[model samples]
Target: MKSNILTIMKKELARFFGDKRLVLTTLVIPGLMIYLIYSLMGSGMMSAFAPSEDQIYNVLVTSPSEEFVAAADQLKLEITEADIGDIDSIKQKLRNGEIDLYVVFPEDFDQSIASIRVGEAPDEPLELEMYYSSTEVNSSAAADIVFSYLDGLEESLSNLFNINSGSAQYDVATDEDATGMLFSMLIPMLLIMFLFSGCMAVAPESIAGEKERGTIAALLVTPLKRGDLAIGKILALSIIALLSGASSFVGTLLSLPKLMGGDMVELAGIDAGVYGVTEYLTLLVVMLTTVLVIVAIISIISAYSNSVKEATTYITPLMIVVMLVGLTSMFGNGAPTNPVLYLIPIYNSVQCMNGVFSFSGSLINTVITSVANIAYTAILVVVLKKMFDSEKIMFSK
Candidate 1:
């Protein structure tokens, strides 16, 4: 029994790996594509967030005091004085990307600070209106720089008035929370997509390709049981799919730092210590079950189709559904606490991943999802066996 399954698995593996073109297209190309795409995206994001040194930022200031003007000059900023009435025109220019930022100071802005220094309540609270167009990268960058300047000004004013607001408070987010926020949203969706792509690449070619070439008939005529054949085919295809998925997974991990603005540890605000062996093992379990389920589904679809082209066409809708299900990780707050939700195949894997990555995954839920996936794969294998037994389905024109 083991020998028959191994023979079938070996044949499938040989057929896939023996062909250099198939191996290249199926395995090598995906990782390269992901790395290239993600790196470019990360580079673009960094560029957008950073200000260009060569480009002079146009700043429009309304009712600026001498101190404010001195600060602007000290920063080597290109400042334009505009009256309150010109605010509408300046906004229009901002929308047109003609200017980077505008700052409006209330008349007697310095007088308010002076009043506070003398222990007198100002007639009105000090206010400043700053505007920038977010759609323009330069405008946004300029706005960030201006915000830093204003923060410094605020600190200086507070010190001058001897206003002690206790000790400084730092960011309240913990390392786990930061890491969880970064990985939970991205990793689950990426894993599902890679697994599905891997299965899609090989499953149809294994089953439908054989059927289309009439090779399945020869195999059926042999002493192998139809159930064994189905199991062997599913297992072989799962191995290949797992390899493909792993390739893409590695690519994603390697490129994620660049994707998240080039500093993974800094960006996640956590060290590798955050995810211990337990989390990795949980992730591995989720990935293994996910590949099995995906491969089984694709195998069943492939068996039903008369040709590889037809199989791919039939599987396209399933791919779409997988992608849609993967998106749940992005919008979802975290893994749902309800155990019943863990029974939903692809969605369950996604949630399990989210939970595991966030360090909040339920072991019971993970176990349920894994068991449910295996159960579903078993059902698919049985259906595939029936399809194999049906001469009409196997040899249909």
Candidate 2:
């Protein structure tokens, strides 16, 4: 019995090691994929959070103090003296992301601090006002630096001065901008993954499963044009995938605020209702085109495969590519501007979605992406039609 068990174990081991593809997929590919993905994610997160070396934070100071200037210099802030009369214009710049920060100081700011440090307490703490747009990254970063320096200074001086003290909101960013920023970073990546999953679920079954069951051969013998058959399969698969993707998209959108934490949502005041019908309609167009592309690509791969399991195995690499492309939205400021980039299939969809969610996407780019995706799908359909007419592929044992 021991010798028989040993022989069985040897046979099993030999079979597992003999199939290079199985070994690669089950053992080698997973580790390599994890390493590559984590490396990319680490790099992406670093680039997203790390400030650039040459970044110059533009700041406007009113009634500037020597100590304040020194702090600004230390923080590498580029300061310009502004008049209180021009404060409204300066605020407009902050909201528009033209300037990083606007700091208002008391006329005798340094003198006030000196007097306060000598144990002279006033009826009210001296206040320093900082105005910035939270939606603008540079402005937010600048405000954080100033706040940190002031916090230390306040501690040393026994809280002699306070920063932006009160119920008054100093962040100049609009509610719409805040909503856009939150949605853009998360929605595009999620949308692509859902759409891809939808395609993966149906495409392999429709094409490769049919082939496995020998139904594809019978269907090929029918009077239906090969091109029509390909198009019909693609459209049917796309509709199914679209329904699946839309359901998930709606669920994700509805759940986002809750996912972001209820108290934080209430505090940040991010309203999902900020998006109008125009944005929704634009997103619908993007989703429809993206579904078509995903379905077409998957259908072709499924048709090329001889069985459902084989198709899924073949599609895994493409799934990884889709995930990598989806990650682009998390790293960039917005979509790429080049018209040519809108021609690449999966990438264009991700960028277009990114742009639309951010409210920074151009109409021309969206149009370009839609047209390019449709064109690619048509080409893929032609290729699929040719594959359908191939006897060697369809009738393969």
Question: Per-residue lDDT of 1-397 in model 2, one digit per residue for the tens?
Answer: 2443344334434544577774464445443554455456555654565567678899988898888787776788999998787778888999998899999998878988888889886678888899998877788889998899888888988855678878887998888888778778888988898889878877887789889999878777776678877777777677767766765666565555545545567677688888889888988898899899899999899998999999999999999999999999888787788989888888888999889878889999999999998898999989999999998788787
Q: Estimate each model's TM-score.
A: 0.84, 0.62
Top-scoring candidate (TM-score) = 1
The CA lDDT at 156 in model 1 is 62
**Deviation from native of the Cα of residue 170 in model 1, angstroms:** 4.9
For each candidate in the order shown, give its overall lDDT on alpha carbons. Answer: 0.87, 0.80
- For model 1 the local lDDT of residue 212 reads 96
Q: What would the per-residue lDDT of candidate 1 be over residues 1-397, giving only the tens digit for each residue? A: 5888889989999999999999998899898888889888988888877766776688888888667778775565688998877677888999998988899988887887677667776766688999999989888877887888877777665665544466864668888888888789888998899999999999999999999999999999999988889989888888888888888988888777787765656855854458988999999888898898999999988999999999999999999999999989888688999999999999999999999888778999999999999999999889999999998899889
- For candidate 1, which ten residues in a row score worst on lDDT? 156-165
The alpha-carbon lDDT assigned to residue 280 of candidate 1 equals 92
In candidate 1, stretches whose alpha carbon ends up further than 4 angstroms from where it belongs are 53-56, 60-64, 73-76, 80-99, 102-134, 147-172, 263-273, 330-333
